[model samples]
Target: MANPHSDHPAHLQHHFVSSEQQFDAAKMGMWLFLVTEILLFSGMFVAYIVYRTWHPEVFAKSAELLNPFLGGLNTIVLLASSFTVALGIHYAQKDNKKGLVINLVLTFLFALTFLVVKYFEYTAKFEHGVFPGAAFDPHGVSHGVDYATYNIPYARQFFSIYFVMTGIHGFHVLVGMGLFTWITIRALKGEFSSAYYTPVENCGLYWHLVDIIWIFLFPLLYLI
Candidate 1:
């Protein structure tokens, strides 16, 4: 019997039975990648739980030094970026190239804003002598804030977890920005449309996953 999808678009691989099949396959692959990401972070979360359990007081006190205001601002920025990406996908589906491009640019800008805020937060920590591992030393005054007061037993554990988690999250944000830039270039060249937007859709899914990770990290590292 002749294949029903033999006339599928160029973007649809010849091996795929249909466009829907290809799309589903791509989505499934993306979900698998997201699952691996979760598993990777799960190890850090377990370490955090164990250390926090052993030194709840230290964890609480150390967390106090972190700026919840900046964390909250980053959370808002990420969420807004997620919304913009969703809007970009919607515009792509509607064949509105201008809307899609605008939303993607907005999303990229939001991601950049989040990273900039994180830079200052990290610098503030470093200036206060809040280093992780053996270099862990909170002494002297920096940025008009004294770190010696935060020198509690096992406080290093808390800062270690903070740096590792936030560092990984920041790396993911950088990657997302690069992905958005590539997509934005493609978007400018009229590469995506209602008929084919797999790249944009996949990128959106990845960005959402990154944002979700931050949602979890914020409360665990900043609030709690």
Candidate 2:
């Protein structure tokens, strides 16, 4: 921690001249990292579009085996978690530690809810043998829905794509939960304030990216 400023903040690193500079630099870095994440997912999206274009029926039919209700529920949970993260950042900016801590905890809980819902969704899919690649073998029927009926040609490709795309997205959600947990602990320790809440802000941006990715994922994997 090198400090040139006689009034330099403790959190401000030695390399940065001012807190504003550090904040801007961090934000720019986060955006750049997010761009990489977008590119990473974009390749998968392109693959999906190409495959779907080649076999629209296969994709549509394969989608039937998916539980849109669970997907929609997880979407709502992630959106709410993003909102909570935003609120946490707002409270941090206002120097309201209690508000910030509460919101961070809430955000963590929402993230946990998302993962829990996703767990059930994954388990149900597994129960039906709806796995990726060669392992795919949709079978059985608990209700009126027959999983065996969904075993169409190129359907394996659709499930593979579904698992890959959603699987990566789910991994991000898990990471976000970890991030929120760490941030919540820091918030409780009173490490953040208006003068320096960069971690809180950065974590919020990452969570927003996670939610945005899922927004694209839900429609591509579930509805359409």
Candidate 3:
């Protein structure tokens, strides 16, 4: 009888000396990356909080301009995606290649849906001339489309921070899409197995971090 372990190929890195080691390394690196990501967004959040404190009225008025319904929907969408991503990692751990692929594909689709919703949100803002800086001049636009008329002095400043925070978050989503795409291709080729599924696990961590960031962002930017 042939040895089952021997059947597995050795395309993985030698630095780790074992599949589990490589997987652990990947997870650790991902956590480090997530820490850096948090720091990156923290700066923006701090700025928002300071500005909100200085101009509480502006932030309050700006909050009213946003539709909590849409924000709630997006929050649900992201939470579901996070659950799917977690399941994908579980499947990969069991060496259930088919299950892993299915979950990953579903997660990718969820990401796409998120982008679509975001597109509509961004379009609505643009049509109303609610952009940052001088572009935010809603000279002759009507508020019949999106609720709450926006023309306050500090309202523009509030939107400036809003756009910057959400824009950066959206950019992260785009980057994650590319990362997951690469992981999916690798998975399709049977690259990950019970012995070596670090890529899947690592990517899963990355996905979760993305979700975590949005959790805070939703409330701060939408609710509060």
Candidate 4:
């Protein structure tokens, strides 16, 4: 007799001979997607490094103004979320539906917290006349003695890149939040099982890619 487990309804896929074949194909596709994403972010990182090198004094000054504490806290939040996402995938593979749901929810919460902190950081900058591009105005540049020492234009350039880079990164976080929400809904509905959770697994891979980007961004933008 055919193995009962092999007869799972999830075993059928229009383009594959078995669920295993479909799972492997999906995993491969997701990895390829992540590779492209890395290349996209690499362009931005290169631009940032080049500009910073060209204006080291300004870059260092801007870095000083950034609250390392907020950046550090967000970093910890993302790392913890990544851990929960990993556990969620592990439990999903084991067909532990409840555990998967719980972990996914925790991941969503962390993402929300990250955005909340980011909002305050951006708002504070704006209030200090740290707007990007032409809107930027250093109130002290015209009055303070220190302004007579450091070049002002260079400072504006640093803030411009800072806003653009972090703004783009924050957009990615929003995308990840949407993905988590979709996967959580499906998991709660019992749409995933040990036999066919490749979609969930693939989504987890995407989330991991986002987390990895933040890892590089943190040190590059804030620490150095």
Candidate 5:
């Protein structure tokens, strides 16, 4: 009793010649999408650089309002998340379903932690009427934080850039959490294994990029 369809995989698309070809094509597409993401973020980075160059003193003084310790803690959390995701991928490749599920869950928790921390930071800014755009108050020191200087319009430029850049990055992190949530359910159902872990692989690549973007953001936004 021989099965004729055994040579073909159920997950393979009809357009693909083979599963390997399908995987390669999917990876290439993900890379292309990541390139577009980089380009988008690059524009923001350039804006930040231009503003800082034009007004270095404003940028530095405005940065004093930020909490570097919180920024550094978030950086560590995201790095841990990236490591857990890599482990999840490793477990998937090894067909260790339990390990994959555990690692993915860990990654999800870490992402949630990042967002929670960001929420507190946002609330602190709000408490001082420090919002983005027209609502922004350059007098962040009105709460008596610095109680001197920093009421100039140039300070608005720094906070505006900070909010926009970090806001977009936070949205990406939220999306990553959602993606991991979906795939973790799949992993629990034994969807991923050595021969068919394309979803996990692609998601990990995306998560890593999210982490890398934050790495650049921390020093640029919080530190000198």
Candidate 6:
């Protein structure tokens, strides 16, 4: 009798004993990456806590300048994108290439929409002189709102953390978009199937993480 493992897929590496092993290894690696990501974000979260503790009023007042409506809309967009990525992985596991492709495309579009909204938000902030650090100067009527009122002490800290955290999250969104684009093209070319869909699964995991980060961000930076 021939070895059943002899017909392993082309993408399988020689080091992996079986496709199951390869998938497990990929998942382990992703988890490790996620751990590092969590640690990285944890430092920023700690900073936010420390500053907010010291200057709660400033932080609260500064947060009012942020448009919660836009933030909520972006939150919805990211949540929807997370759902589409999950659906993509489901279709990939079911060997439904067309469904996978469609979901991936939708996920990318949702991500793009999020960034577009963010672009407008950032532009409004810049126009209002809501910059970080020593350049922090809110003086002028932009968006028909006077930003000079927001020029409270330590308010820069809040905006700085807001920008850094959300900026990093947005960067992840862009990265997820690239990953989905690659996976979508592969799906269109019949690269994924029930037998070999590790890429889709891994990318879905990444997309979900990005969405999760934004979920945390929306409330911390907008609602709370």
Best by lDDT: 1
How accurate locally, in lDDT, is each candidate? Answer: 0.92, 0.90, 0.81, 0.83, 0.91, 0.89
Please report, as a residue range, the 10-residue window in candidate 6 with the lowest summed lDDT: 1-10
Of 3 and 5, the candidate ranking higher by lDDT: 5
Clash pairs (backbone) in predicted model 2: none
Kindly indicate the candidate among 3 and 4 with the higher lDDT: 4
TM-score, per-candidate, Cα-based? 0.94, 0.96, 0.90, 0.89, 0.94, 0.95
The regions of model 2 sitting more than 4 angstroms off are: 1-6
Question: What is the TM-score (0 to 1) of candidate 2?
Answer: 0.96
| Winner by TM-score | 2
- What TM-score should be assigned to candidate 4? 0.89
Judging by lDDT, tell me the better candidate of 1 and 5: 1
Error of 3 at 54 (Å): 0.8
* Model 1 pairs whose backbones collide: none
Give the per-residue lDDT digits (tens) of candidate 4, residues 140-206.
4422233323337677777787788788788988988999999999999999888888877887888
lDDT by residue (66-179, candidate 3, tens digit) is 778887888888888889888888888898888888888888888888888889988877777788877786544445543335677778888888888888888888877887
Q: Indicate the worst ten consecutive residues by lDDT in candidate 2.
A: 1-10
Separate clash counts for every candidate: 0, 0, 0, 0, 0, 0
Give me the overall lDDT of model 1. Answer: 0.92
Report each candidate's C-alpha RMSD, comma-separated, in the order given. Answer: 2.6, 1.9, 3.4, 3.9, 2.1, 2.2
Kindly report which residue pairs in candidate 6 clash with one another.
none
Model 4 lDDT on a 0 to 1 scale: 0.83
Q: How many backbone collisions does model 5 have?
A: 0
List runs of model 1 lying over 4 Å from the truth. Answer: 1-6, 142-145
